[model samples]
Target: MDRKKIVEIISNHYSPLTPECKLDLITNSKLLVLQKGTVLVRGGQFSDKTFFIVNGCARAYYLKDGKDISDWFAFENEFISSINSFFLNIPSPHFIELIEDSVLLEISRGNIEILSNTYHDFERLSKVVAIKTMLKQQERITSMQFHSAEEKYKNLLSIHPDINQRIPLTHIASYINITLETLSRIRKRLTRI
Candidate 1:
């Protein structure tokens, strides 16, 4: 949760930051330690803060009727934010919840605007991060539409093999658009084959 460490991690993702930009981020960002099951962003809430995870994990989900459908997960060294709300200044459609006890560095939207306006490199870095985020979301949507549950599961495992160790089976099943029973069967079959 150290500001220096958080800045260093984020810098690695986009581009090298100027000393002033780093200082501004360090000064504006705040550390939060969230407990498991904590809801950081609720659907329909206006949230302008973005989080950088330093440790542990979180999930973004949408509530349909009474069911919670997980859309994405953020682990250590990942960014988690209500993108629609953060970018458009509207209520969020997703709820972000802490899946494990986590350390996060939070930056407000206003501060991000200031940084982007004052620093050209910061703006470029933000664009790169936004592009990457959009691409990941698009890829997820494509996989969900074109791939079977087992195929999605395998692809997820290939990218994040340790995810099963971090999240519960039920959440993983929901994320991959499969039932818990189906996921269990898939695991059993994979083990046997």
Candidate 2:
């Protein structure tokens, strides 16, 4: 994965970085190529790093009654991390896995702190990312509480049109809190209408 391209993508979403900050990220962060099914963060593991996906996709999940419940997905040009654990400096309850073969730029918490201290733009970018992440989570929770299964599916497609093509139906069903059969029916109904 091209470090410059990855930096550019993140910068587009967050803020423009100085040449020095960009260079620091490129040098301090490690590029990782993960195979599909690779677990980057395991439940109960202390996670100190955040992944910036340069290619492919990943999912964060939790185990509930022996079943994996997918919480969220991160694709290319997005960030993935055990937010609770990373911020609190504790073991994580969520597991992060690569759903497709992925390339990521891994930045440790220490390095992130260093960047935040050294660059004002980096701090602003971090705040923006945190706020965006929280807002997305809140939106998902609100959708589940207020929307029907079909409405949820339609809204998801409206926001992320390529999700059905990229992610497995079962995982999407799990994320939306619907059964696979129900999701299939919804898809069929959507096609006809």
lDDT of 2 by residue, 92-164 (tens): 9999999999999999999999999999988888888888789888999999999999989988999889998
Off by over 4 Å in 1: none
RMSD in order of candidates: 1.1, 1.0
Please give the range of 10 consecutive residues that has the lowest summed lDDT in model 1: 124-133
Rate residue 26 of model 1 by lDDT: 91
Full-model lDDT for every candidate: 0.90, 0.91
| Model 2 spans > 4 angstroms off | none
Report the C-alpha lDDT of model 1 over 30-130, residue by residue, as the tens digit. 99987999999999999999898898899999999999899999888778899999989999999999999999998899998999999887888788878
Global CA lDDT computed for model 2: 0.91
Model 2 scores worst on lDDT over the 10 consecutive residues at: 1-10
Residue 47 in model 2: lDDT: 98
